[model samples]
Target chain A: MLRRFGLVCVFVSFATLPAHAESVRITQDIEARTITLNGAEIVIDRIQDSENRLEGDFARTSRPCPPFCITPMTVAPGVVTLGELEVMDFLDASVAAGEGLLLDSRLPEFFAKGTIPGAINLPFATLDPANPYRDEILKALGATLTGSDWDFSEARQLAIFCNGPWCDQAPLAIRYLLQSGYPAEKLSYYRGGMQVWLQLGLSTHTPSGG
Target chain B: MSATARVTTTLNAPPDYLGGNMFLASSRRLPEISMLRALAIASLFAGITVALVLFKADPGAPPAAEGANVTRSSAGFDNLAITPTAAVPQVAQSVPQAGPRIQDQGHVASLPAVAADVDLQAMTRGVLAELGVTPPAPPPTDTGADDPLHAMSMAALSGLRKMTGQPDPAQSPSAFQTLIAQALQAGQSDAYIDALLNEAAGSGRITVPSALVTAEGRVDTHVILSTIVAQAAIASGQDIGAAKVSSSGRIQPGQQQVYTVSAGDSLGSIALRFYGDMSRYNTIFDANRTVLSSPDSLRVGQRLVIPTI
Candidate 1:
């Protein structure tokens, strides 16, 4: 009896609340509240705490234009732009199934502090052509190598993000991938990123130190 | 150095144009001296190359293999050396040169993962073969082992595969495997678990019966979790390890959950158990304000309202 109930309990976690308590939903129709990202089940929904203040690096309102410029609707040609719900869906499906990756394009230091639960830290600088090990990173994304040229026929679906909509790091990383011959069809851009993620009170997990 | 010195000496003199005023002569004759010197050195180098070409024996004369492939130019990337060459096929003129890349003014565009499976090393050598190096091929250099490029390429695939928590397909699913999967699903990292196990071993709480790494070079999470569960079972001292341990974090159909406080019970620990997050202790405190006096005060056998977060 416990085993069968345990299996059902594994699915999601938004059942009990008082009459006055408001339920946070990702979408009106759908609520796969807890999702498997990377390898763990994380509460992707809003934190139930109403008093939780937006604090730390994510709380800051503005940054300078040159480095932290606003990104476009689409990151690169043929690269699909996704919102928070789409990101959650991708995390629950493709990423969970190992057919896709949710990449956090921030530097390791920024990523280490906290990030979207399922995102792996693939720094934007590492994707640059200047990096000698760039081919290795592309291969990690499931691109097969035939000598020095990359073969992305079996490349994983990659959805990338940096700090937020104003950050160009993810866009730059996307450009680097294209330079290395990565197909734009397999790429996705999560434009809102961490800033919006915090605004919605979404849970963030600190990745283990490398 | 010897050849350059000889070339410079041979071009030391100047025509009788500028008068032998030291400053005027020095400035006027400098360009003429360098140009003449360059010509002399070029001839010397040309003679040496002619000698090498004439005398160098044919070792690996194989060019018929790459006669079919086209040599095209790839632009923008600096380290990548895909140069265009002539003399491969006659229809090569039909292949157009690549155009310039679109520059992002606001620096707001992205790139993609192209699936070009062309052999770059073979193509590089093919370019050489097209460049009249059909007589002798140089020795091959292998840059495989300890290569940072290779490591970065495989990190995502390996890291994601491990994250999946699914064992290799060859292995049959077991109960212990299920236990390990649950532990990974709990969200703490392998390094964290390793530290926990190390601490437990140091404290003499659990026996380190086996190595954490398996013979296949995979981290044996199976061994680690099994030890932890067994230790917890022994420490708890109950039937099947404890009095039916289950998470209170599960979604309930009811609006509230009531739990009688047990031994060693605290609001923080209860909050962690009920919500899967210890920091939400105030949620419980605020919910059960009528019953509990403060965050720290919790009496035995008190019914606490565990609110869903």
Candidate 2:
């Protein structure tokens, strides 16, 4: 009787196993189309593609050297060097909160193709000392003109980027900003820029949407 | 007795000449004189040939390979007599010409080393001023000229108009309505249109079918904006004592070109059209950071900056 009872128990256990088996889940890959930074959503998609291929200066394998060589790992002494993720975080903390600006330091041509979310187009050439429009750009960045000198007491924090590591535009703008008395500590360098951002499958939006 | 002996000896010597010794001496002396005279004449001819050759070999003379070869071979034979004629032409051509004339030739070669950097602003300013179009004031040294948007504001335009003796004018209801419709069709938010309209109303007043407006009959938000800008330019021009004016400042090449995105337009396609290379899409993207957050997000009719390459 005990043996028979034990066999009956095993049979019951076996019958019950199918119920639990149905409830057990199988792991699957998850692809996210959007990432929320702070309260804002960043769509991760390639900005410009031709026949399913993306285009632009950043698409080039090699750019002319001397002017467009890859920048150093650090831009300046006190400026923070940031990767794509760090840039997104900064975008959330600074741009979303309206505490700082995300500046696209390339020419308007480069900036038009696509850029990080929350970035404003401020061409590097516009801030170049030789450009007649430099002072106007400085004023737009919230610099106060005291005689011929600029005062940056009310300047917002700036996170600047250009084409990518190979682009010198952002570095030029940063150096000019520093020379113009912008606090280096308040500046963040998004060195990866649009190249790295797109490489990692991040979302981008057009200017019209903003 | 010695004198008689000497006279007899002289008479004997004369008879000895009859033995043909005198004839032998004359013959030897005549050959010596003739050989020396021939040598002297040959040296004079050789010197004359050398001087003539040198005079013909002037640098200003046109290149004549055959003539040069002849002169060179002549000199070689006169100096070293062993030089072959066949080698002289090659040697003459191979030798590089050297002289002040050669140096002068280099300077005379075409092409200016340093290009004149033309100041387009100064050039245009002169022409505009001569035409009674007062160019915009030179940028102030003080900070007042620093804010670019300041001069574009409604208050600034009104102030300029007041200074120019232009009274507040009425607007063309039809043109104004057309602007509103176009702005709405362009997908501008109502709030944005309202604000823009209010701003435009406050700035410069213009009427349709007036001589003050540009003849561009297309009534759109662009026309509306341009009308106000024109009014501002005219007012400012009057303030500066100009007889006529259309715009304030010249559009610089460094100023970004605005390209309207069309249907089926991608950054790559737009780049290929504007830059002649699809790969330069990044340039377009980088220029429009203010409007584009993504390369894929280009909208029809969206204005994009096509930056100068």
DockQ of each: 0.07, 0.01
Regions of model 1 farther than 4 Å from truth: A1-18, A30-32, A37-39, B1-161, B164-309
User: What CA RMSD would you report for each candidate?
Assistant: 34.1, 37.5
Docking class of 1: incorrect
lDDT of 2 by residue, A109-204 (tens): 555667776676777666656444454455555566543355787767888898788878888889988887788988878888777776654666
After superposition, candidate 2 runs with Cα above 4 Å error: A1-59, B1-309
lDDT tens per residue, model 1, B1-309? 333433343344233223333224134324533443354346555654554454455435323212211121211111111011111010111111101111112211111111222111222233222322221222111223324433343344345446545332113323323333333333233233333333333343433211121111122222233223222222223122111112323335456788776433445445434543232355676677687544444555678877654
Q: What tens-digit string does per-residue lDDT give for candidate 2 at B1-309?
A: 322332233223222222233233223323332333234334434544564566677746443323322212222112111111222222112111101111111111221111111122222233223223344443221224333433222222232223223332222123344454344334332223433443343233312211111111111122222222222233233221111111221123456677675433445435434443233454566577688654444555688877764
Q: State the TM-score of the second chain for every model.
A: 0.22, 0.19
TM-score of each: 0.40, 0.36
On a 0 to 1 TM-score scale, where does candidate 2 land against the true structure?
A: 0.36
